[model samples]
Target: MSFKNLPLLGTAEIIGALNLSPKQTAAAANLAHRVTQSAWRRRPPHKSGQTYEEFAAAVSACAWLTMFEVGALLILGRHHDARILTEASRSVHQAAHTGRRR
Candidate 1:
């Protein structure tokens, strides 16, 4: 179960050594998939002159804004308050685009 052993083990072997329950394993897998997908999707263009740190910051900001929008939409439901979510999403989108163009 040591970090040093991780590199030598197959995925199943690692999972077994960790003794994760089925639900825990599934959740871990799902989280790993999400992280992988996000990394792939947000990877900066090669030779774009942007540092990895800058790209990561932008990606994190976008993800946070997206989650905020979703939460707002859910909380507002289908009521008139939904307009707030729409406006917030629009503002964030506009700001992101504006920042990128500078």
Candidate 2:
């Protein structure tokens, strides 16, 4: 499946919704990138696209999963900023990219 090239989204509203400072959001983004790269490194070339397409797929998958997680956490009243900033996005992106390769 081909992923549409999504426009880069503004994160100000999302950050406010999550009650995360810019610093925390940036940290999460950096961690997610690293994890995505690691996942890409292990992806089989025959199963994945060029760097841009594969990365786009990974990012799109990550965003969708993160939104679902954050929404669920908010509904359950379990959203913790530290937990989110530290590991949530990283794990989500890693899983997304890894699964995308199969």
Candidate 3:
């Protein structure tokens, strides 16, 4: 599938089309959800601005693209984008991991 087909599909569709492993797909989906939700929560109040949902969608889109790169890197065993993905996963996971400390 091409880039044009990406917007027409949801996370599951994209994941299936890419044939990513279950672990990779799950990480991508989780990242997408987190990015979207985080963007939503950051929606600001201003005279000129995009809605939170819109911001979230844009963020989710970018995250989805990065996720594709992640899957590709993992499949090829390349370390190029792995560090970025790993760092992001750690950051996102930390929110949950440290929740009990509060």
Q: Using lDDT, give the best candidate's number.
A: 3
| lDDT, candidates in the order shown | 0.47, 0.52, 0.57
lDDT of 3 by residue, 1-102 (tens): 223212435655656766777776655555545545565666656512776445644554545566555655565465756677867866876887699789
Please provide, for model 1 over 40-101, each residue's C-alpha lDDT reduced to its tens digit, 9 standing for 90 to 100: 56665782566544544454434433333333334334335446655776798899899999
Model 2: weakest 10-residue lDDT segment is 1-10
lDDT of 2 at 59: 59
Query: How high is the lDDT of residue 29 in model 2?
Result: 52
Q: Where in model 3 is the C-alpha error above 4 Å?
A: 1-19, 47-63, 67-79, 82-102
By lDDT, the better pick of 1 and 3 is: 3
For model 1, the stretches where C-alpha displacement exceeds 4 angstroms are 1-9, 46-102
The per-residue C-alpha lDDT of model 1 at residue 45 equals 73
In the predicted model 2, the residue pairs found to clash are: none
lDDT per residue as tens, model 2, 40-60: 777777846658456646556
TM-score against native, each model: 0.35, 0.44, 0.38
- RMSD in Å for all candidates: 12.2, 8.6, 10.6
- Name every residue pair that clashes in candidate 1: none
Candidate 1 to truth, TM = 0.35
Whichever of 2 and 3 has more TM-score, that candidate is 2
